[model samples]
Target: MKSTINTSQLITLPDGRSLEYIEYGDCSGTPVLYNHGMPGSAFEAQVLNDVFKDNGLRVICPNRPGIGRSSSLSEYSLSQITQDCFFLLESLAFNKVTVIGWSSGGVPSLWQAKHSHTQISQVILLSSYSHFAELDQAPSHFAGQASVLKQVTTRFPALGLLACKMAGYLLKYMPSLYFKLLMQHCHTPDSDIIEAHPHYRDMLIEAQKQSISQSASTLFMDLLIQFREWPFYLKSIECPVTVFQGDRDPFVPERIGQHLADCLPNAQYHLLPGQGHMYWFEKSFQYRLARLCQI
Candidate 1:
């Protein structure tokens, strides 16, 4: 179970399902469980690969159900995902960890702080949301191919699955154009960053392809649940929490991050002005993330 930089493995859970994960950083360093965003897979955790190693941190990036190599679940709540995380850590002999959630991943990250705080030292949310209702404020901002998929999946389950299947087909056969439209719709800052760093865009496409190929149901279910009311409230969580968001991130507005921070009794909010949703791709941001976890 020793960690190795950029190594991938699969652990079988008690329910006969497998959890796939990729590890980076020092094998014996403080364990940091990273939760990736929507339509993203474990590979997204490698954004700060070198920073984690330099900071003496062990980062574990696991694929949620129906994503990557992980098995799918027909119906599961956000809390159930938290339980999956606990089992994954226990199997690896990790009693406690620092949980870091990015974007949609933040839902379970908050849940961990509330339901599994006993085994969580700290919680961090990057461009994340505290509730689904927050998205109502900027519906136009989320209008895109992504929004179409969500709407289809939520309103017509059968059609949603078909849409995911077709999308997956396109991603596999026509990846370049698929990513082209994706980046074309991105905010100026986000698109600029991705253009400057081709690898980031490539990573995104690869991860997304893997996600849809595995089982689009998981992605659809995630989006559907995200549109409804979350089970827990931010004010109820007592663990130390930190929220980082880009001031110009329309999908997860700066105000939403600030609002979540305000509701949490022990939380701090850091807004990166002018930056878009993918500010975490910056080295400086990665360094700050490492420092925050270590502290």
Candidate 2:
């Protein structure tokens, strides 16, 4: 399938905030809301443009506040972000949508499923973080700078903000080194996949660049929110959810996905063997998505 790269469009919210978003695939096709990962932006959706177009899926990927061209908020909750998404859907006249949340985006996606169950048809979480408390319980299970960053961000936010700023600087000025450092702790498959696919690597680099294009403060707050306790219970989400996790993922443990699936009343967990965090870019994922949408 040919790739489609649509320019971002902006929508002004009732609260006077501008939310920037990118659309992919057929305009009149099946509606989908894609929640990008942390250090990611709407551009992340471009990686899957071919799959979306092939499956006749209309994907609406929005940049969270403080990312991309969206208006930054001093104080915002996951619920507010979810509302922003719903408002965008309303403006687009999309009454129902399938939500796909990757990494940190899963929190707000779950919020959407819980709060707006009527409008949400289904949800898919890819290598997503479950809960901060869950991680705290088994600190040893997760390792590397990501774990340390979470701990620092939870206890010393000021330091965390500084760290995020440094990361943003690296992403903006020294992306090559930034990615090199990032892949240092990644599983072998993850590194190999990135090295093999230049498009995928470029997509990720661009997403990270856009993520901190405005400021790193929002990124810090995003991390803080993820570290703190979530407001909703997993069991409260009535919509069917499918959780995908790579067993070799270094950042998010496979058991976390299982635990999340166990909590949800209607959720299925799929563990991908010999896969890593970047497994979503594989053909298997595209096939799964096509099957799920019954295309």
Candidate 3:
């Protein structure tokens, strides 16, 4: 398939589920697969796509199951999302991939190392927690923490849409106001030069998993089953693993990331001071990515 700037390509999972993926740059070049954080859409890949376009690498970012256009299954788990990624790559004729997973996407990246290490040259996990205890260190701002509040309105599966509809309105409207006030909390803002775009957040709400209630419940379930101790089953992986963390990441703390890097058999960890969990859009992040991938 030819690469397009912002175009999305559809790929089907073995279960006949259609997943949404975006590709950028030359298809024949070294393929770098991107996995985004939870409740995030592939739109988040846009910045990185533009930055790495001429770097002789093909970038691919896919929407996870139950997010965006991807089909959701009742039996979905973090491990299964990893397997789904494996088949998606195979279906797309991706023989080998250098994976860069962010935040929640790190779970599937570990899954890749565990089950498909032979097909991956290098693995990168960014701003992700390797253990359940790490959750305690997450800043109060992570929306996943608010997922429980969203789920309370949808206790009954049948009336899920109503709850979702209500939650969506609040999330869509509140974030804008919050960002305005909280911009100073993290970094100094240059409103004149940079107009912040919450495009991915908009796309997330417009997804087929449109119901905030359902998505929250599904994530709640994933956290319940996964998000702890790197699953230990990831022992088979021998590839060089790189864990990226930000000094002030609201979701990932330094100690937790250090623990994860120490646990990996062959791993290198990089700490980006003054950067937060969403490092993809930062200029400093681009340089770090270049250095990490040796582009």
Candidate 4:
């Protein structure tokens, strides 16, 4: 499959901030708005390009503010970010579309589903974060680390900013080392999946590299926002929602997914056995995409 990396386009929002995005797969097919992960960019969607093409689906993947070439915001909320996404959709004349959020991307995706239920046809969350209230119930290691980071960042914003900058530097300069360190936290299945697919590894590395190509301020802001209390209620989302969680995912354990599903009024929970956080890179994800296409 051809790389979608070079197909990125830019649009100027009403506030004069530039938003960078990429459109891949069947352009005229069913539109799907993809909200990439926190430390991700439009390139994250490259891994699903083949599935998107085979399923005749169009993907609109955008880089959040301060990531890639998108203009950074000194102050922004999830609601404001959601508005940016909708503004792009409105500019494209896409009145209704399926929304998919992976990891931290799920926060804004949930906001989109809640704030604009009339325009959202379906919502899919992949190993997404639920409310901060559920953090205590998550895996101890993941929850503890998250809690510490949130506390540290809250108490010392400069330290957090420094850490984000260091991470960005590592991603840009020593991506292999960065990937190696990142995989240390992954389950065996996630590492095995990446080892088995060299292309997927490359895609992930490229995505990470692009994520902070501009700066690391976005990463810092993303974590800060995620750690804070979400402004909306899950029960407010009345649209059909699907939550896919890997039983072996270390970052977002199955319990977190279950909690998110239980909170949503109309959500179906799917627990994939033996899968990890990066399960989307596995072949099974294509089958899931095919089934979603039938909806």
Candidate 5:
């Protein structure tokens, strides 16, 4: 399927950076900004294209700095990331918006809520982790891959970057094999969902290619920052927020979601019995979100 993004809509930032974003759904509908996960790009929005369109929602998915066509940032911080998003929204003539984050994408969504509560109508996190520091006690199987990377990156930055390069290269150049291995690591619920809906797998592969093709370092940078301590606290966010977690998620434990829900000043936690990390890609996701939006 053709992408919903218009190249003509690309905007230049004050720092000479480019903000590449794609629009989906009704042109005159309510606005929502989707913050994609690590190793993702604006193309990630394609997975939810039909959902947004049917709901009469205007969705904007942007490629973060160092990903896709956007310029790389020398320094990375959650605060700066939120500010950049604010600038992009303002430039697009949008003020109030619903922000949705998935996986690692939750970092920015939470930061945006903390920094610009008045501008954000609501915040939603899908299979997200609260922070890396607090994940010490999470499942060892889930932390194993990340822990190795964090350790290597802390000890040898060059080697860490090379590892990321190799991983991204495999993802972009050898996607079929890469995804096969990736599926092996997923929980049963997520694997079943992907196996049933082959198109969803294609979407993930394409998003990875789009992101890595632009900058292999982008994923590495995201990982480095993800392991460090976050600048803000979950309790600081006063906006209406909801966290959707899957009981079978292997990447992020259910306990993390429950803890975050407990911490957020105003947040609700919804747990799905047999779902997993990729539940957001399911067709029924739109209806679930619609029901929540009505509340």
Candidate 6:
């Protein structure tokens, strides 16, 4: 809740959008740029930032274009987000950096691998799919589950909005509930991570509420756009890539992660046991990242 970390001012994007990010650890350290998942804030990887901080590795997490104190892009696409992040990297003068993308955030990372592979030293994707259509495999389908988001507005619009607003309030106070819900929805076991960090639950919830205002349809569309002929991009990427997928992931079937690993020429694939999308932000993620980065 209270942060002693002093974050610099927001960085403006080429599209006139502003992104808020936190920078910490030694500036001379190797830069590790982190992108958060959909409906998540810059704080989504707060736990990972903490984990990687002391190792002389610089960590950067922007507000992901819209969530916390960041400005929204009038027209958004994963390519544009990746370009913006590339500019940010240029501004920082980090000639090369490692990229870590988690879940929906992996879209932009994938874009980078396809379009800006030269700038990347390595890419680490967690619980990421090769294409967007994989959303059908995702465990939590707000569309199929309840359509509570769409139906509530018609049935009890006022109460629905109020509940969303309240949910936002509760988020700031109860981050743990958020993480638990995410862990549950991920439909994968994370007992090792769970036993270690109980407080992450509240942090995760805060992240969800922070970006909850975004339309669900638009979020779904993001994956749709990414899915259509997505494999082509994988074939084009020449950089070193690594993927960590949760075998039990209800959202992305293990088949996809397997197919991707087999497709990429320089990819190292790992099917993390009893994990899911949340693996990216968990402490366990470090082992994978460090191994891939050769740190």
lDDT of 6 by residue, 14-128 (tens): 7677777876544556688877775566666667555455455677777655556666666656666777788888887877878887766666777777777467888887766
TM-score of 3: 0.75
Clashing pairs in model 6, backbone N/Cα/C closer than 3 A: 132-227, 137-251, 138-251, 139-251, 175-201, 175-202, 175-203, 176-201, 176-202, 178-205
Q: Compute the lDDT for candidate 1.
A: 0.79
Of 5 and 6, the candidate ranking higher by lDDT: 5
How high a TM-score does candidate 6 get? 0.75
For 127-245, candidate 4 gives per-residue lDDT tens digits of 98887755544454244244567777777999999998998998888888988888998889999988898787778777877777777777888888877777667888899999999
- Model 5: per-residue lDDT, tens digit, 1-295? 2224334257788888777788876667678888988777777777766666667677888878877777778885566677789998898789789999888888788878888946788999997757666565445424434456667876688998997798787896788898988888798989888888888888888887876776778787776777777766677788989999888877776877877787788998999998878988777887687555534
Error of 4 at 229 (Å): 1.3
What TM-score goes with each of the models? 0.89, 0.93, 0.75, 0.92, 0.89, 0.75
Q: Model 1 over residues 96-162: C-alpha lDDT tens digits?
A: 7889998888887887788874689889999886664544453343533435555676678899767
Quantify how close model 4 is to the true structure by its C-alpha RMSD in Å.
2.6
Q: Provide the global lDDT of candidate 4 against the true structure.
A: 0.82
Better of 2 and 6 by TM-score: 2
The model with the greatest lDDT is: 2
What lDDT would candidate 6 get against the real structure? Answer: 0.63
Model 3 pairs in collision? none
Q: Each model's C-alpha lDDT?
A: 0.79, 0.83, 0.63, 0.82, 0.77, 0.63
Best by TM-score: 2
As for TM-score, the candidate ahead, 2 or 3, is 2
Q: Could you tell me how far off, in angstroms, the CA of residue 278 lies in candidate 2 after the best superposition? A: 1.0
Candidate 4: residue pairs that collide? none
Q: How does residue 81 of candidate 5 score in lDDT?
A: 72
